[model samples]
Target: TELQEIAPKEFEGRIKRQGVVNALDDEDFAAAVRETGRKKLIIAGVTNDVCTVYPTLTALQLGYDVQVVADAGGSPTKMADDIAIRRMENAGATITSTVQLLAELAENWTSERGGKIIPFVMGLMPQQ
Candidate 1:
């Protein structure tokens, strides 16, 4: 998974790797958000089949708005990826790019978060 690639050995620290769960099924993701005390959540994983669909569907069912980082999360094949995106989108999930998430998290360009984020953006940008 990309998360593992990004931070090898550290990914498991934050992920509850049950390898997909009934807890992530439609009604449960909502209860999870309420229980965790955080309105904001970032959902991502491999294989759009279960990882993306189950949790996204669950999160939406729970009334917790979700921001799915499509670029950060991907499926096994291009077709599988496209299908997953379309399926989730039809289910009212809003798909987003990795950069979009950073921008959204920052929320405003004139604030302190924005000022502090330029370097991170610069690092992510490809060399011209």
Candidate 2:
């Protein structure tokens, strides 16, 4: 993949890339998000404390509406993740679930896009 070329071979598939950033301050990532013309962002990362919080704070500072998917943003410990979530919330980032975001985008179940989206959403969600 393109990421394998840009990122070091050591990274391999472990890198979850929205855009390439080798540092905590990621101008390229911010620019990439801006290029998409998307003001609202859903942020997740392997280590929630540093990886997720840094970008979420940056996006919030840049006047973007940010949502941090708590479950998706894993941490070394639950305490660390909780702390990061609290910090993000304090900085005006919304803590949300993947399901909530998908539901918002999909809207009604009867719509054309909804037909496709529902199945995908169902796969993400457990039978209830």
Candidate 3:
């Protein structure tokens, strides 16, 4: 699997599973998340309608602060994507874009983390 093949060296020993559309439905994945002891979750899945929506709603119900990276996931159609976004928002998940998430994490461009992230983000932008 691409995920397993491309996982970074730091996550080598981490639990990585396949075959579950809703990741939270997998006991191992859910247990791993619980073990993290983190209340906030940043989630992005391949398909917004199924892979993303199901878990976002479940996480909200489970009392985790959820942020769905909108642009990171896709749907078969624009309408499907919009519907999924609205559903998640109504369920109390924060919908954010990739750039927005990076900025929120970096905070200030003058800071050490920002200094590195800004350059990487810029590289992703199209040159005009």
Better of 1 and 3 by lDDT: 3
For all candidates in order, the CA lDDT equals 0.71, 0.78, 0.91
Model 3: per-residue Cα lDDT over 25-125, one tens digit each: 88988999999999999999888998999999999999999999999999999999999999999999999999999999999999999997998689768
Best by TM-score: 3
Which ten residues in a row are the worst by lDDT in model 3? 1-10
Model 2 root-mean-square deviation: 5.8
lDDT of 2 at 18: 59
TM-score of each: 0.72, 0.75, 0.89
Taking the tens digit of each residue's C-alpha lDDT, what string does model 1 give over 47-88?
Answer: 566576777877777676776778776777889899878887
lDDT (tens digit, per residue) of candidate 2 on 7-112: 7674553524455433225565445667789788888876788778888888888898988888776888889988999999999998987788778778988998
Candidate 2: residue 47 lDDT (0-100): 74
Candidate 3: list runs displaced more than 4 Å. 1-7
Clashes of each: 0, 0, 0
Off by over 4 Å in 2: 1-24
